[model samples]
Target: MSQTVDDPEGRLVSMIMEANKYARFAAVCDKDGNILWNSHRNNVDNILTLDETKQSLRRAAETWKVRDTLAEKIGRGQYAIVGYEKIKRITVPLQNGHMLFVSIEGEKPEYIKDIMKIVDYVERNH
Candidate 1:
């Protein structure tokens, strides 16, 4: 008999989803915002098209550039947290220039804590 296990990527997404009730979307993408894995197809939220994903990635890249510049002048940046009118985008830089992007509905203080936990989990596990 053979046992089959969920892949690491799937498991990571599951962990993220389970960890945050308001998590609208979670994804792992390159610096260019090319999504390697996403939770949207799992019925997370509004399905993101390829173009939308690309555009989001581009915007994230720009945001990261600004963050890096600011960090250089002041201190190291822990993470990037961008708040939109409806949702909040939390990004954590991973190894190899990849990023873990997680979006949660609404702007809440808990989002920061959730992101920190998620980032720590990813850093330790992935």
Candidate 2:
């Protein structure tokens, strides 16, 4: 996929979608959980409705707020993972209070490494 120079966050989503075939959905949201950019793999159906997704992200943002309060004592959060039977959800904290939300297929443990590579990409480029 070609990336537009002006849209770094969009490019980030595109790059993430291409990073691994198992990647089902990728998104960048603000501290308030407003989705800035998002993409679902072609032919993949959404597992949640738009409103549901927004609400879910808002909850995640709230949790991150709590995490931030505890960061000084326990160190900053790198990422968080929640696995379900159908998919694995990974949330990575990004610069400027943005969050990267990614969902990949299946529950394979090894996929974490591949996802971490994506996290590394974000750190290096964004």
Candidate 3:
């Protein structure tokens, strides 16, 4: 018998896909605010590139309309509600301490938190 293992990208897609199961959209970013990946409901992991993802992340990061304490925390790598609509953004530090800013479903912070932990764990162990 033979088995297969998911590569980093594969695992990343899987992790993101799982996150999208609850979040309207999920994405991972780097320390300097570059988007590593993004997934819609289908979780196909296609139709985008690293550069494109980074652009989206940058746009999302600069999209601050609220003057609350949480908005300030974003520049300093903190997790809180950011979007105005039903979307919530959570910026988290990954295993290597890189930041992953995610703007997902407002009612699904837990989904991002759960996948965030997994992303941290996988990268750390690898």
Q: Candidate 2 residues 6-115, lDDT tens each?
A: 46567777877876788888888999999998888888888889898889788888888899999999999988888889988888888778888888888754676776
lDDT of each: 0.69, 0.80, 0.53
Question: Which segments of candidate 1 are over 4 A away from where they belong?
Answer: 1-10, 41-50, 69-73
lDDT of 3 by residue, 5-101 (tens): 3655335545665645545545555544565554556543433465775775665444422322354564544344556455666655444544455
TM-score of each candidate structure, all chains considered together? 0.74, 0.88, 0.52
Give candidate 3 regions above 4 Å deviation. 1-10, 43-56, 59-80
What are the C-alpha RMSDs, in order, of all predicted structures? Answer: 4.5, 2.0, 6.8
Candidates 1 and 3: which is better by TM-score?
Answer: 1
**Which regions of candidate 2 fall more than 4 Å away from where they truly are?**
1-5
**TM-score for predicted model 2 compared with the true structure:** 0.88
Ten-residue region with minimum lDDT total, candidate 3: 1-10
Better of 2 and 3 by TM-score: 2
Point out the higher-scoring one by lDDT: 1 or 2: 2
